[model samples]
Target: MLTVGLLGALVEARRSLELSKPKTQVQWVDLAAPHGPVDLALRLLGDETPAPPSIDPGLVATWDHIPDHGAVDRMLQQALVNAYGFVVGYTDAMHQVCRWIQVLAHPMTQTTNVRALLVGPTGVGKDLVARTVARLGRRASQPFVAINCATLPRELIVAELFGAEAGAYTGLARRRPGLFQAAADGVLFLDEVSELPLELQPVLLRVLDEHAFRPLGSTTQIAFHAQIISATNRELASLIEGGAMRADLYYRLAHVVVPLPSLAERADDLDLLVRYLWRQVDDSDPPEDIIAEVARRAWPGNIRQLRGVIERAVLLRKTVGSTSSLLDEIKAAPAAQPVPSGTLSELRQRFERDVLVSIVQRCGGNIRDIARELGITQRSVYNLLKRHRIAPGK
Candidate 1:
């Protein structure tokens, strides 16, 4: 079927080829088939080295008070993490996030339509910020609705965001409003915004522009008098440069950009996260030595990894009925692999290769999409394929 289709396309392209490039001789070109994600990753790394750790946006622990991990929204949470990491004289980068909580208190925070963008590493508690805002508002009427763009199906995203009338799509049988309508006078969080399809950007942009959206197949338009909070672990700017996302949509969503520091970067947050996670896992107070032990190792997986370690310790302790090997259990989990040492240029090339491979994986090796996403010419895309030795196509 593919051969027949290609044969037809070749014949159809002949007229243009003859008219435009009558003098240019034609030669058959052999293009390699697209590589799988694993093959691409291996090519990028230039060895059998594993790919970078993927961030899981859905992982969240049960905590109502203040964020113990990446939750740097409130003053109390900051103070809790202040034990070992917070410096008294250090320049406060989080002043904006802290000031936001202070300035936007109660009714205003709940009622206002201010949008925010949270940028940070995975498991940095970006999700908790909206909850914190709602709590600080102290209003139960303001509902909290969240959606992870990475998790949603590409085909159903529009329906998920704007809702749909019954039978709008093949499987959707009943009428339902999307995240915007459901958010109603509350907060609607869009996590992993970069994963959102390019085609949906304009639609979302229209909704933001009008502050209203019509449901799929519905004539009635509803107002979105709610806060739109977007968070992304990936770099949206690069995506914009490559044309994966719209600049207008990014500007609309990022009213106030809050950057959350990674777990390894925040010292005080370790104590806060470990204690909070320990509280959930065990009834007793978290031992200082245990906390210190957790703080010692590298946390590549960030908050998700830290939470898993504590949770695992509890289960392991329960089985043995003794805390003697609790520290052992924590240490038993393997640490993240160390980055290979190299000169600056070499390191940059390595990073570039990794990013290119990631984009390839995301685009499924589509030549045009990869080129557009990289903001480079298609020839450059072919050049990169040759440079990195990455096969094209899915």
Candidate 2:
């Protein structure tokens, strides 16, 4: 049974997701008033005037003030640096993700059965790049199959990928089609592909070369035409250098390499993401101060870990003092940074200056809030601000 509160929460979560879609798309449509569930739903979203009296106030508040992810993406300037701003930093990574796939999904690239390799740390949404392409590309009507190489049994992996005959392996009873056949003319996502066995690399390479593969115990070969997308958390160069992964296979899979940025790399995006994730997990909007606190903290595990923390915070909010616990965790986690070469004194000064600048900007140049938060006097705040060449207020 859906209570009014539960219904409102679901609306907020959906609205958050919908708002993140490409703003270029026409989102709203004119319709006759409240005759069906669809029309009622639109009224709940505030897309129609005079929402039913049953609508919760919280739901109304959602349309009034919610953090929008698409707006954040659009704010980024797409500088076409070498590697598409990868060398410069993914200040525009989230915004540019769709653009990367649009190129590969384009009809011109589709004929080639374009192979793409996504490289990034775990939980950084490496799979999203491939998934998006699959969902929107020319092959959208076909099946999209994803398999994690790490989870496949070493001995049975070959049979699983290229199909096997009744007598191909021990205990085999009947011939079975593999994922490759199922994903034909579609997309095949090989996740955690670094875990693929070294001996199987040659077989995969052969398939890529010939655009065909012979099933185990089969007399004939099957044509291959799937759009292949491979992903890994490990660096291929190091793997090749370590002789763990074949260099030739790496090149074939990396026809178009895409990199996804981690959460810490998206400092400016924190506010929008927090609102997005918060609404995703719960109906209500997250507190603005919590969003600010999140921006100051480090998220080592990227969005995956940040989402877990946010989900827990929402679940525990009914408990007294839970907000403090959230703040405590943020403050306790040391911000992640690369070590710099400098004298001890110089490094300490740099750290202090950085801290002051962050706080000053977050505080909107309010001297009193800055002093209170830092446990410093107003005089010390001004002195530090001057020394760091920071102007008070954002």
Tens digits of per-residue lDDT, candidate 2, 1-394, equal: 1111211333333344455323222122223321111122222233334444654544443322436644422222111111122212224655456456667777767778778898888888776667667765678788989999999988888889999999887898999898899898999999999889889999999999999998888988999999999999976764675466889999999899887777765676677667667766677778777888788777878788878878877877856646777778877887756436797579657887888788988888899999888754687678778777888955
lDDT of 1 at 340: 63
Model 1 Cα lDDT, one tens digit per residue, 1-394:
1111111222222233324322222222122222100110001111123333441223312223223423322222233233112211111434345445433334554456667788888876777765655544534367788899999988788888889999998877789878888888777888898788888888889888898999988888888787777899876765675567888999998877777766655654566567677766687656787788777677877777778878877776678865657788667755534446897478657887898889999999898998878776677778767887888853
The lDDT of each candidate is 0.62, 0.68
Weakest ten-residue segment in model 1 by summed lDDT: 35-44
* Model number with the top TM-score: 2
TM-score of each: 0.63, 0.64
Q: Pick the candidate with the highest lDDT.
A: 2
Q: Which stretches of candidate 2 lie over 4 Å from their true place?
A: 1-90, 318-321, 338-394
How many residue pairs clash (N, CA or C atoms closer than 3 angstroms) in each of the candidate models, in the order given? 3, 2
Model 1: pairs clashing at backbone N, Cα or C within 3 Å: 34-393, 70-124, 85-268
